[model samples]
Target: MPQKFALKQYLPNSSRLVYGCMGLGGNWQRLPLTDGDIKQAHAVVETALEAGMTLFDHADIYTHGNAEETFSHLFKQNPALRSKMVLQTKCSIRFADEQHVGRYDQSKSYILKAVDASLKRLGTEYIDILLLHRPDALMEPEEVALAFEQLLKSGKVRHFGVSNMHSGQIKLLSRALEVPLIVNQLELSLLKHDWVDAGTTFNDDQSKTNRVLGDTIEHCRLENIQLQAWGSMANGLYTGAKIDSNRFNDKQNAALLATKELVTNLANLYGVGKEAIVLAWLLRHPAKIQPVIGTVNLDRIKACAQALTLELTREQWYQLYVTARGQALP
Candidate 1:
């Protein structure tokens, strides 16, 4: 029998894996998005659709908003393809350069204006999912709730969620909003499991600062908020780096090698690629994770989409985790 795609109640029953367009138009350093690049990105989306992958993820700050523009350009040229897919985008996180960064904005004015800008750029009236790009310390939950209410009423946005927020923040926002915050985009991978052992007295307080993965994962399940894994490939830390580099020191290199071996074995067994094994590792969790893959390469996109069918047994999943951590399971 053919494999079936898993669907979360929050998003329309689309593909199990979502294609992230952050790196499509250009890189993050405010590079110019060329016509050829745009065409290539369109081809990636077309290929994804042809493979039965329909969900596309984007954000206003991605490539300084040029990613959305590229998507809009492609959708305008191929209008029929728009209805066949589910479109999602993010807002907030203002930055002029790598140094001069602006604070997060979740006020009614910012949210309203941001959605309008996204709508114009996406060339669509309604976004399937709208997520706050990051947590704004000064965000007024009531104002955000009001803005979401208006968007829902105006048919501009259908669902809402957040990215890189703690459980407390998500809970606070839920208290003030009537709509369910359906998803939380987070950083999760075998090598980046700080959230898993965050509060277990690892080394020092500084290392524990960002270690809230367990809380965030558990809370999402309790709240029925889907967990979306961003940086699913660990920003190419596992695949592209040299094994002898200082960054991937002896211990880390050994872990990477072990992971590589496991990935290779699983890929051959599943008739997929190593990238698919990385994604399958995350999906094996009970968190109902949907990986947001950011690959401009069409082959990479197809490889990631194949992860939807690669299933890992419980013991194999734990073995990968142990290999990544360079230690036995606690």
Candidate 2:
């Protein structure tokens, strides 16, 4: 049988590269968005769209919810653009304020309210996919399931998923959910390879013996849930001049310089931008990891799309992995 929430099921022509809209909205300081902010967002959206990237990833708490508000300007300018893309936004993150500390809320009331607020901000009646921003410590599975059921029945959200979740939590939530959870967005990149290290160094007693995310990856694969990777570019760790500074500690900077050298060599061999090479490594996985890139610069955004077409060989992939990990396989 086919998987319940395959990428193509919702996004047939979706780019393997998902665009993160966190940079669209201005800073989170509550200042009014300037005309330049809108213009930058417009250029980013236009660049991504032209590069065939249609799946946009958003969170209600991004830039204090102004990110979605900023993106709405695009649709307002070209209303038809709304139908041309697959829009996915997240809820459940309650920002910190005077009244309450920052926390996660999966309660029925909060979930429902967050969805309505996100819809209003996006200026859309329905969301393509609605993801719970994070796992709530006090989450009542039945209450969350009820909210999802109502949202689906009311045509407010089409799909459901979670971020930063593991297998045990997903199973606990799935028991009460009539709809299958489809996506797990994780913080995965060359620099942050905990997800891969645990598997590669299994049974070894090095610094990377936690193996926490191993079961989560296996469960997602078995359940046919798509894995979306955030921070896919690693905050430009390998982007020129960024790693050449003297501020970092000796050990840390030394490791970075080594990895940057390896990345540079691979970039030359592959004849593509370093960002594409980095993203392509994630794409080369059998799990079909979809990387969400957060770059707003038009040139970098377009450069990242190149990962969709590039293919890294098995040896090259492992080489990049070993270099990034700064150690050899056991």
Candidate 3:
């Protein structure tokens, strides 16, 4: 039997890369979007499409919901593009306002309302996937399941997933959900390095306090859940961003420099840009991780697309891992 919500079942043609919409609506402020913002967004959308990246990851709270609003312009101008795209947006993380503190919401009412608002903003009748932006500490699984049922039945959201959640939480929620959760988005990159550490550090002292994302990578893989990576480029830390050496200790500084050098060497060896090498690190994982990139630079976007074809050998992958880990693996 096939898994109901597996990535292949729903997004068979997903480019294994996602264009993050957080950077689409301009700066994080209350002001209205200017013409320049929409123009910039068009470049990202068009470039990403050209690169074969059809999934656009968004969130209800991204840029005060302006990100989805901005993206809707493209679909409005060309409705045909909607059929060619897979739109996934997140909800639940709320900003503080005059009446309430900023918080994570998983209440049934809030979930339904958020979807309606997001649908309106995106100008779409349905969302290919709706993810919870973050876990709610006071989440009630039964209520959330009810909301999911409504969304699924009404054809507002076709699929569901989450961000920043662990394996146990996913299991608890899945027991109540009618359809399987298909994705888990997280901060997985060479710079963060904790996702790899969490898997390798079990039974070692390093696992005691260092494991923030406990076995999530393994759990997602075992469950056949698609893992999408955010911050996968590490803010150009390993690629080309100028480092502030003063902020790191001597050990950290050495690791940073060594990793950057290795990335450059591999890029030249592979005949592709450095972005491909960094993204390929995540792609090399057996879990088929999809990286979400936010760069709008035309050349840089194409450079990132190259990762879809670049294959790093086992030796090179471990070499990058050990250098970034800053020490021998446990």
C-alpha lDDT values of all predictions: 0.80, 0.85, 0.88
Report, for all candidates in order, the number of backbone clashes: 1, 0, 0
Clashing residue pairs found in predicted model 3: none
Say what the RMSD of model 3 is: 2.6
Q: 76-101 in candidate 2: lDDT tens per residue? A: 88899888888999998888899999
Q: What would the C-alpha RMSD of candidate 2 be, to one decimal place?
A: 2.6
lDDT of 1 at 171: 92
For residues 1-330, what per-residue lDDT tens digits would candidate 1 score against the true structure?
333322355555567778888887766776777897688878988888876778889998887778888888888798887888888899988775588867888889989999999999888889989999899989989999999999999999999989999899999999999988888888878777775556433565554455555477778878888778888876655554455556777888888888877778878888887788888888887776887887777777778777777679988887788788876643
* Best-matching candidate per TM-score: 3
TM per candidate:
0.90, 0.94, 0.95
User: Higher TM-score: candidate 1 or 3?
Assistant: 3
RMSD of each: 3.1, 2.6, 2.6
lDDT of 3 by residue, 1-330 (tens): 211224776788666888888888888887797888888988889999998888999999888988999877877888888888899999999899999999999999999999999999898999999998898999999999999999999999999999888899999988988888999999889988788888788779888766777878889988988889999888888888899999889999999999999999999999999999999999888888889997767788899998877789999999999999898987
**Higher TM-score: candidate 1 or 2?**
2
